[model samples]
Target: MRMKHLAIVAALVLGLTSSAFAGQKIKIAGSTTILPIMQRVVEAYMKANPDVEIAVSGGGSSNGIKALLDGTTDIAMASRTMKDKEIKMAAEKGMNPKQVVIALDAVIPIVNKSNPVNDLTIDQLQAIYAGKVTNWKEVGGKDEGIVVVSRDTSSGTYETWSHFVMGKTRVFPGALLQASSGAVLQAVAKNPRAISYDGIGYVDNSVKPLTVNGVEGNATTAKDKSFPVARTLQVYVDGSVSGAAKGLIDFILSPEGQNIVEEAGFIKL
Candidate 1:
């Protein structure tokens, strides 16, 4: 009787261990813009719930959407809304992408600190990027030729800029394109004449952020919609989210998760 009792206890322990190890794991991939906020929130979530596992990555927003349609990632991060074409493509693949707005963001234009230009009107910005105004002197800056830096076409930041600043016009062909927001910051900071745009969270002492039509890019301006370059930051889930995926999403929308967003230098929703 003693030996049979010990065997039952051992079996119970093994079953509990198996169940704990079987907890759901979620994978999130996309927008470099949303990477920092997601990282901090997920780190907190994992600590609070030890059984859940989450993986996060950044390869621009478009790639994140592609991952969702391909059935590779549980969540897709985006700085801009899904284009109609992307929605259609996902439908063709039988995948429905649902967006959850997690925060607000303002795309701030940045220039090297040494540059004297402080603000730019909408038309002036358009002319400069359209290749019509090639020299800084035209815009009350130095006499040197302007060094245009921009995000790659695949980037959601680029799409936002193109819509608001460029009026859907293409950036000048001569502009240099960077792969990520960090890359854009680095390129602009290193070159005195270089001008580029990045999320407000990415703004730091390395580069000077320019005012758009005299309105600064910040939480206040973004929330009031006074900032011309503001947009929503989102995470796209496949159909109805459940399990670990839903847990993470719920935590993000909670007050605790929104606090993480603010702590990461973004405007919390």
Candidate 2:
């Protein structure tokens, strides 16, 4: 009996050891928005291949890119396209940046639920950020001062918003610069006089999404090119990725991933 028990224990130990060494854990880092979607995909992959492990993190696009360059991360997630200089830097570093489009997110301009203003044209939005439009009454809202809220320069959302909405114009001095999309949503939701922008994923019942040039920002509008603020969510792969990393990307572009994107309040691309 003792000899038989020893044989069984030895076999189990060897099997466990072999399994541990069978596959490698894939390291990944991404933007906060991409984190959830990526996680869902990874979890699904793990169900089929239990030997693989995936690690994810978020420190904004720049930070994700930095991690890839510095070898701290294997995958970089971005909400916006890489800048020309970043692509050049990757080349200089002997790293190839592989871009995979995952989803579409509208840079939804939101206002306090109490604010009656609902519609805005491109020029009017440009004026508001450029300090030209100061009163809500000018755009058919309440006869109150227009309080501008915005994201800081470090935010990729701000970069896109400034480019598409401001048209290379500046977001006038004293505009409230929140840190993240959630913060922007919160500020706009609570302050009746406030107006700010966010990722479509952040839109909810608490705040109201404005119609830009009379175009609504739903998945349909984004797909039809009517959502003026719609932007692509991207995943950047540095060097060759393991099956795990590739699987995560594939999932984001898959039906399940798109479902998660839609459930998160963003548009599925």
- Candidate maximizing TM-score: 1
Query: Which regions of candidate 2 deviate over 4 angstroms?
Result: 1-23, 46-51
- Distance (Å) between predicted and true CA of 177, model 2? 1.6
Residue-pair clashes per prediction, in order, are 0, 0
- Report the C-alpha lDDT of model 1 over 1-269, residue by residue, as the tens digit: 99999999998886664455357888999899999999999999887667777899998999998888889999999998899998999899888889999999999999999999999988988888899998999999999999999989878899899999999677999999899999999999999999999998899999999999999999999999999999999999989988777878998999999999999999999
Give the CA lDDT, 0 to 100, for residue 30 in model 2: 50
Residue pairs in steric clash, candidate 1?
none
Model 2 deviation from the true structure expressed as Cα RMSD, one decimal place: 5.3
For model 2, residues 97-186, the per-residue Cα lDDT tens digits are 888888888788889998888889889988989889999999899999988998877667877887789877899997988866677788
Give the residue spans of candidate 1 off by over 4 A: 1-22
- Model 1 lDDT on a 0 to 1 scale: 0.91
Query: How high is the lDDT of residue 257 in model 1?
Result: 97
Full-model lDDT for every candidate? 0.91, 0.79
| lDDT (Cα, 0-100) at 6 in candidate 2 | 100
